[model samples]
Target: MGEVLWENIIVSILAFAILYFLLNKYAFGKLFAIMEQRRELVVSQLDEASKTREQAHVYVEEQKQALNQARQEAHEIIERSKQTSNKQAEQILELAKEEADRIKVDAVREIESEKTKAVAELRGEIGSVSVKIAEKLIEREVKNDQAQEELVDQYLKEVGGRS
Candidate 1:
């Protein structure tokens, strides 16, 4: 009975040791390798996500720079248009001023010509009136005394010569 009990205990211990060795060599080792591979895959995915995020940020910055450049170009075009418009306005104003000056000069010339014509006409009218008055006075005096006409003509001739 003692030998049989001892033999049974030894067999139980041997079975436990064999089970432990099989689990460590096959099940536990393969499970641990699978877990390590999954961890590495997750780390690689995180690294790829970080790289994609950085690329997205850089793209956004480039777009912003392009937008700013476009805005600046638009502003420059507007300023150039304003400058051109101002220059055109100045040219138009100068042309108007020149036209006005030309009109003024023409008007002054016309007025001066009219004034000269009026003075010459007035002088002719005054001379005709004086001649008429002198002729009427001489006619009146000559009818009264025909002998005095010869002496009056000689005296008038001498006065005209002096003037």
Candidate 2:
């Protein structure tokens, strides 16, 4: 039994040493290299994710700037349109005022011309009536010059009152 025990111990120790050496030289190196490669892949993927996040942030900022610029341009366009409309309205108002003034002046001139024509016609009628009255008085027999003059004055007064 003692001899068997010694043999068993020696054999177990030798086997353990040999196994440790073999794993250290071959399997352990390959396993560690594979683990390192996996770690590097994880790190590179993390870096790529960070870069993509930054690019997305930049894109969002650019979109915001573009939206702001478009808003400003739209505001300017609306303001310009308002100004143009106001200017047009002013021009139309001015033209209307000018036309009204022209019409009023023409009406006043026409009224003056008609009034002048009416006055001239009245004067001509008065002259003809006076001439006819004088002819009638001359045809009638008169007693005295003073009486005829008085009758002529009275008739002239009556005609002037009627007119």
The candidate maximizing TM-score is 2
Off by over 4 Å in 1: 1-37, 142-163
TM-score of 2: 0.71
| Cα TM-score per model | 0.62, 0.71
Model 2: residues with Cα > 4 Å off, grouped in runs: 1-17, 20-26, 141-163
**Lowest-lDDT window of 10 residues in candidate 1?**
154-163
Residues 23-114, candidate 1, lDDT per residue (tens digit)? Answer: 99989899999999999999999999999999999999999999999999999999999999999999999999999999999999999999
Backbone clash count for every predicted candidate, in the order shown: 0, 0
Worst 10 residues of 2 by lDDT: 1-10
Error of 2 at 59 (Å): 1.5
Maximum-lDDT candidate? 2
